[model samples]
Target: MTKSPYFPQPAVASNVAITTEAIDITTLFANAQHATAGGIVLFSGTVRNHHAGMAVAYLEYEAFEPLALKQMQLIVNEACSKWSLSHAHCTHRIGKLAIGDSAIVVITAHAHRSQAYEANQYIMDRVKAEVPIWKNEFFTDGSSAWGNNTPPINSK
Candidate 1:
């Protein structure tokens, strides 16, 4: 995908991140606050304890970081353009994650609650559908598999 003209420079691109460390939700919420924003929404996707009737031990995420970041930024930018958003950001964690650990976070700020909520969902849906991230699920039965056996992106 082509770069967005509205994309922030690398130094200021804290809005989208991929990390092996734990995601700092407090900092992300603080950063998403805007003077005119009356509504702020944050969504955290956490690793659950079970999947497909199997007891999950843990999960590992991997991504093509360069493309993942780019796709995440694009999703955020699209949300901003589609709504009256004051701020938007997304961070996804990589490497191993235990049950109940946050895997992804999406935060959005808007002048109204409905816009904030809708934009937040839109960003997440697009991220899950378009980003080049992969998940591996490890079961308590000593078995593991790639999540859904597929990557999110189709490489169109």
Candidate 2:
């Protein structure tokens, strides 16, 4: 229930966070929604029980706070510029995360559903590709490895 100190003021039109706490989807959605926006797209990435045929036990995420925040802001701003967005908010959870735990969330508000959906996906894809955040996947078989950093083809 603790807010991440890494988060800038939530009142900012563009909000980003990298923290060890659980992501508050409600707060993020509220922040992104605006009276002028007709649509709000929310994407939540959860820690799954499996990955690539391996049984995942948990995941440990870490990030270079300053650079990660800078990159997140850049992604948010880029999406905002491309679409008629009222607000955009992204929050990533660091530290150990168990199955069903939300690892990240992206909320984008726009005048139409198409723009909101596109911008939300774009922000998440760019964050995975360009941000300094990293994650280690731990399997139930006691094996672990770094998570994939491959960017989606459409990210560009």
Top TM-score hit: 1
Residue 156 of model 1: what lDDT?
25
Query: How do the residues 74-93 of candidate 2 rate in per-residue lDDT, one tens digit apiece?
Result: 88988887785777889999
Going through the candidates in order, what is the number of backbone clashes in each? 0, 0
How does residue 115 of candidate 2 score in lDDT?
Answer: 81
Q: What TM-score goes with each of the models?
A: 0.86, 0.86
lDDT by candidate, in order shown: 0.85, 0.83
* Span of ten consecutive residues with least summed lDDT in model 2: 3-12
RMSD of each: 7.1, 8.1
Candidate 1 local lDDT, 82-129, one digit each (tens) = 785878899999999999999999998877899889989999989988
Clashing pairs in 2: none
